[model samples]
Target: MDKALRGKFGKLLARYRVTKGKGFRLADHDPADTAGLDYSKAEARELLARGTALLAEEQSKLYAQDQWSVLLLLQAMDAAGKDGTIKHVMSGVNPQGCDVFSFKAPHAEELDHDFLWRHVRRLPARGHIGIHNRSWYEEVLVVRVHKEILARQKLPDAVRGKRLFDRRLEDIAAFERYLANQGTAIVKVFLHISRKEQKKRFLERIDHPEKNWKFSSRDVAERGYWEDYMQAYETAIRATAAPHAPWYVVPADNKWFTRLVVAGALLATMGSLDLAFPTLPAEEKAKLAEARAKLVAEKD
Candidate 1:
């Protein structure tokens, strides 16, 4: 993308970003808000294609340079299209340079350590991209909404009180800052979808034989806590959003637009880093030239 388009894309994504002190309120953003986009469906697809191509190039450069890492955190209510967003936006990236981790219920071994321990161990090394379907923020989000779960984590009394959620948010901010300082760029996204939209998706899953396996009793039970989840999301995002690790509250009722916004946000973030493929060493260049000369001279 050209400079003008890049700037435009950045500004568009910024509309949904929750930076420090901005304070995210889910109610303020409509899950179906496509007013910021003037493009048609086809145009949105084109934009996503351009972004996917740019992301591929950037990922290659990132791998070659081995100087930086990226972490993409996608958090959402059920049926908000997190899986589809990941599948479409990252389709062009080399699998070798990417790692996708889905954090579900904590395994026994995982619970043995700090909340961030499992995720910390799974962070991408330099020159790689790590995508978390659900992340450590779940500790504050789900656990905060369901206080019983938090109590069961066996955390110290220091973090168990009326201000417990605030303390966890503080810890999250500190953790992200540390990651940023250590050469990781964080792009956190909350796929914001309306209750009605979620209901529609759930109905589809129930009615379609192919999608029947996607629905479960838990999903229905969780639907009852929609307001609680939104509140938790607002609290966590407001407390943790930072310059280096910003949160984007994406309107996800429209899957196509969500992909475009996500792809655009990633392009802008990586482009801002000014990534470039490393130049070969003088000796390596010489060896390559010699090898080329030998191949040219041989009968083909």
Candidate 2:
């Protein structure tokens, strides 16, 4: 992607990027803010197609160099289009070079270790992309909202309550900073969707037989804690967002626009890495030329 192309969408990302010490308040960001963007669904589709092509090319270089890795963690409320964002934004990347992990309630075994242990284990190796649908932040978001879940973690009394949330936030910040230092670029995306939009999606899921499987009563129950979840997300983003691991609060009301922003942002981030295919040494190039000549002669 050229700098000029990236700059256009970069503005969209900059508008939503939550910088550390900026006193981020989710209430201030509208889920439908498409300021300065006058693209139709068709236009967004075209933009996404271009962005994904660039992303695929960048990912190929990333794999060939085998130097750096990328981790994209997407967090959102239910029906906020997290799945759609990942599927559409990453559609062009080679599956072999990318992996997606969806985190749900922790299994009994996962609870035995630190909250981040499971997530850290899933980090992508060098020269690949890792996508976390829901991530370790659930410890701070869901668990914090529903306090009873925190008691199950069996933490020492000294680290319970606000202390626990604060400590976990610190751990996340340090963890991301360390990953950045170690050549793993991190992009955290929060798909901001309105409660009304969620309800609409949920009803659609119920009304359509093909989508019925996606509707769950649990999602409905959680809707009652909308305020709690919002506060938790706002606090978590504010505490953990840093230069190395910035958070992009993308508007989720328009799925097409969301996909475009996500794809464009990812491409811009990976492009900054200056990833390139590995160069062969002079001797290796000479040997390859000789081998190619021999193969051509044999074929003739």
Candidate 3:
């Protein structure tokens, strides 16, 4: 995508993120549809710059309203450009109000609690934005695919069958609904990059001097399970999608498009809350006018 179009795309996505939900669906992101967009590097640079500014403006409005929170859950396989998406799409947000949590292997304390326990503790406060690098969905994806992990959870032997999977899903849905009721709007993005794209990015990590630090042997190991992860992602998206918190399958083969879709999803989710500043009482408004007049007179 060219710089101008990239700006257009970014700006549009920002608008979509704040004002979305009218026609949003988790399955609407189709990789096939995104492959053909052609834009130059110069164009992308311009879009990225403007998109960044617009994001700040949108965030200001969201904060001033202080009525809701926007949660972005990004789930993808290794070598799937999660870092790049975070860098570009979220660069414009306020640092104080935006929280990005990356979940890795469970620690001793994490293992002691229920799977949802750690994640629930990190839920974004009102008027804030929370981005989960990998999330509670990991319980289903990593555990279901590798059942042995469940043995560590130490649930009772009676409820130890495949029904455990169903229980996890229910917990996720119920948790999300409770968040919604408490004034959070969530948008989940599944970055859909082809295996070919994955290989290319992996090579970039190896071949590029600056990116060499990013490559790991385990990345290749996880790459081997790409198909399994895809199926897991598909199932999770279908199961956890709810009216308050829906997922968007973003075509992430192109970094620019990926940023746009993710940004759009964020703006859309936040915009849905009918956000506005609290109305000033008439007496307070008059007092504020008098205060300002006094300040102006003192300055004179």
Candidate maximizing lDDT: 2
Please state the error at residue 135 of candidate 1 in Å: 0.5
Model 3: which ten-residue window has the lowest total lDDT? 14-23
Pitting candidate 2 against candidate 3, the one with the higher TM-score is 2
TM-scores of the models, in the given order? 0.94, 0.97, 0.86
Q: Which ten residues in a row have the lowest lDDT in candidate 2?
A: 153-162
Give every collision pair in model 1: none
Query: Tens digits of per-residue lDDT for model 1 on 1-300?
Result: 467668767877878877774645778898998756678888888878888888899999999999999999999999999999999999999999999999998888887788889999999999999999999899888887788886557788875788877877898899999999999999999999999999999999999999999899799899888888988898888888888899998999999889988987888888878799788899999999999999999996
Give the alpha-carbon lDDT of every model. 0.88, 0.89, 0.74
TM-score winner: 2
Per-candidate clashes come to: 0, 0, 21
Question: The CA-based lDDT of model 1 is what?
Answer: 0.88
Better of 1 and 3 by TM-score: 1
Q: What clash count does candidate 2 reach?
A: 0
Off by over 4 Å in 2: none
Q: Candidate 2: how large is its RMSD? A: 1.3
Which residue pairs of candidate 2 clash?
Answer: none
TM-score of model number 2: 0.97
